[model samples]
Target: MRNGLSTFWDGRGFDLLLVGIPLAFLIAISGSALVYNVVMSFQEVGMFTLGSFVRPFAGLKNYAEVLSDPQTWPILGNTAIFVVGSLSGQFIVGFALALFFGLKFPGSTYLRGLFLVSWVMPGLVTGALWSWLLAGDFGVVNFFLRSLGIINENIFWRSDPAFALWSVVIANIWFGTSFNMILLSVGLASIPEDLYEAASLDGANVFQRFFTITLPMMRSTIGALLSLGLIFTLQQFDLFAALTDGGPNNASNVAQYWAWQLSFREYDFARGATVSVMMIIVVIAAALFYVRSTRHEVRG
Candidate 1:
C-alpha cells in the first residue's frame, strides 16, 4: 500500500489528478447545468414541474412557440443592434486609445491605467451610473447636449422608445471600451518595431505603414477580440436589468433579458429555456471562433 501510494504520487497519476479535478468540476457543474437547461428547453416545464427532473416531453413546441411570438423577432433585432453598436463603438474607441497610448508619451501608461476604472466596475453599477447620467429631466447627458446646442430639450433616453435601446448601447460602449483598449494595446505592443523602422526607411508614410504592417499583424488579435465581444455582449444582462429592464413597452428588450422575464417574471420556463438554448448556440459559435483565432495567433 505504501509503495502504491508513492508510485501514484511520483508517476503520471499526479498529472491525471490535476487534469481530472478540473474536468470533473466542469462536468459536474457547467456541463450538467447546460445539459439540464437544454433538456428543459425541450420539455414542458411549469410551476408545478419546476422542481422535478421529469416533465412532459414538449419536443420542439417550445422552440416553435418562442419563434412565433411577435416579440421574439423584434427583441432579436434589438439584440443585433446592441451587439453591433456596442462592439463597433468599443473597438473603434479602444483601437484609437491604444494607438494614442502606444506613442509612449510621458504619463501615457498612467492615463491608460486610469481607463481601466470602467472595466473594473461591476456591470450593474455602471448601468446605474449611466441611468443617472441618461435621465431625461435632470441627467448630465441632457445637460451636456443642451449646452452643446445639440438638442432643444431633454431626450428621455431611458423611457422614450425611440432612444431607449440606444441608451443602453451607449452605456455598454463605455463599460467595455477599456477592456478592448487593454487587449488591443497588448496586440499593438506585440508588433515588431523593426517592421516600422524598415517601412519608414522605405519612404512609407504613417498611413502606408499602418495599413501594410500594423493592420496585417493585428488581424488575429482583432478577430479574437471581436469574437470575445460577441460572447460578452450576448451575455450582457445586468446593464439591461438596471437601466431598462426590457421596459418602455419592450422597446429595449433583448434575448437575455427577455429570457429572464419569461422564466422568472412571466413563469414560462419552457419558452425562456428555448431562448437560452438559442443563445447558447450562438455563444458556442463565438467561443469556437475565439479559440481558432487564439490558435492562429499563437502559431503566427
Candidate 2:
C-alpha cells in the first residue's frame, strides 16, 4: 500500500514540474517587460551629434511633471466617461441581445453567424466605416435624418465638441457589444434548466426570474467579464485613432490616446511612459478588487 501511494506521488510531482516550467518562463518574461517599462518611465534623453540617448537617473521628475500638468484631470475625466459609457451601453445591449438569441427561434443559427461577422472584422475597418457614416457632410446618417425632417442642418458628429465624445463612444459600443454577447450567452447557457423550471412552477415571470435567479447565479461570470472589459476599454486607443484621432479640440481624448500623442505626436516618450504606468496602476487596482470579490464569493 505504501509503495503504491509513493508511485502515485512521484508521477504527480513530475506532472507538476512539467506544468511549472513553462509557466515560470512566461512569468519571467512578463516581469522583465514590466520592469523595462517602469525604467523607461523615469528615462530621459538629450540630443547629441550622433543621436539622442537616454540619460540615467531622472528619478521622479517624469511622474511629477505628469501630476502637475493641468491636462491630467481633464484627460482622466474623459477617460472615465468613455469607459463607463462604453461598458454600461455594451453590457445592457449585449446582454439583451444574448437573451433574445438564447430563446427558441427558427433562424437562431443564422442570426448567430451574422453576429459573429462583426466580431471577426478588423477594428480599423469598423472604425473607418463608422467615421464615414457619421461624417457631418455627405454621410448616409445625416441624409436619413434630413429626409425625416429631424433637423434643418447636418449635425457635426465628428467635429462638434458636444457630439465628438459620444460619436466615438457610439462606435466603441458597436465594436465591443459582440464580445459581451458571446460571454453572456455562454454564461446563460451554463445555467441549469431545472432551476428555471422550478422558478416557472412557482409562477415567477420573465423579469423576476432574470433578476432573482439569473443575475445572482451569473454574478461571478459577469464580474469576471466586466473586469476584463474594463481593462480593455480603459486601454482603448485604436478606435479613437482610426475614427476621431482625438480631434476637435481634444474633446474625445482618452488616457491611451493622450499617452500616444505624448509619445509619438509630441515626441515626449518619458511623459508617455508616465501616463502608461499610471494607467497600469489603475487597471491593476481594479483587477485586484475583482479577484478579492470573486474569492469572497467562492469562500462564502
Candidate 3:
C-alpha cells in the first residue's frame, strides 16, 4: 500500500490529479449552472418551478415570445450601438495612448500607471462618477460644452432619449479604454526595435511603418483584443443600471440589463433565460475567434 501510494504521487497520477480537480470543479459548478440555464430557457420556468430542475417543457415558445416582444429589436439596436461605439472609442483612444507612451519621455511610465485607475475601479463606482459628470444642469461635461459654445442649453445626457444610450457608451469607453491600452502596450513592447530601425533606413515614413509593420505584426493581438472586448461589452450591466436604468422610455435599454429586468423585475424567467442563451451564443463565437487568433499567432 505504501509503495502504491508513493508511485501514484510520483508518477502520472499527480498529473491527472492536477488536471482532474479543476475539471471536476468546472463541470460541477460552472458547467452545471450553464446547463441549467440552457435547459431553463426551453422550459416553463416561473416562481413556483424555479427551485426544481424539472418543469413543463416549453420548446421554443419562450424564445418566440421574447423575439415577438415589440421592444426587442429596438433594445437590440441600442445594444449594437453601445457595443460598436464603446469598442471603437476605446480602441482608437487606447491605441493612440499606447503609441504616445511608447515614446518613453519623462514620467511616461508613471503617467501610464495613473491611467490604470479606471481599470481598477469598480464598475458601479465608475458609473456613478460618470453619472455625476454627465448631469444636465451642474455637470462638468455640459459646462465644457457651454463654455465652447457647442450648445445653447444644457443637454440631459442620461434622461434624453437621443443621448441616453450615448451617455452610457461614453462611460463604457472611459471605463474600458485603460484595459485596452494596457494590452496594446504589451503588444507594442513585444515588437522588435530593429524592425523600426530597418524600416527607417529604407526610407519608410511613420505612416508607412505603422501600416506595413505595426499592423501586420499586431494582427493577432488586435483580434484577441476585439474578441475580448465584444464579450466584455456584451456583459456590461453596471453602467446601464447606474447611469440610465434603461430609462427615459427604455431609450438606453440593452440586452444584458433587459434580460435582468425580464428575469427578476418582471418575474419572466424563461424569456430572460432565452435572452441569456442568445448572448451566450455570441460570447461563444467571440471565444472561438480569440482561440483561433492566438493559435494562428503561435503558428506564425
For every model shown, the clashing-pair count is 0, 0, 0
- In lDDT terms, how accurate is model 1? 0.94
Q: Cα lDDT of all candidates, in order?
A: 0.94, 0.84, 0.95
lDDT of 1 by residue, 166-254 (tens): 99999999999999999999999999999999999999999999899999999889999999999999999989999988979999999
lDDT, model 3: 0.95
Error of 1 at 122 (Å): 0.8
TM-score, per-candidate, Cα-based: 0.95, 0.87, 0.94
What ranking emerges by lDDT with the best candidate at the front? Answer: 3, 1, 2
In the range 38-83, model 3's lDDT, one tens digit per residue, is: 9999999988888887799999999899899999999999989999
lDDT of 1 at 42: 94
Off by over 4 Å in 3: 1-16
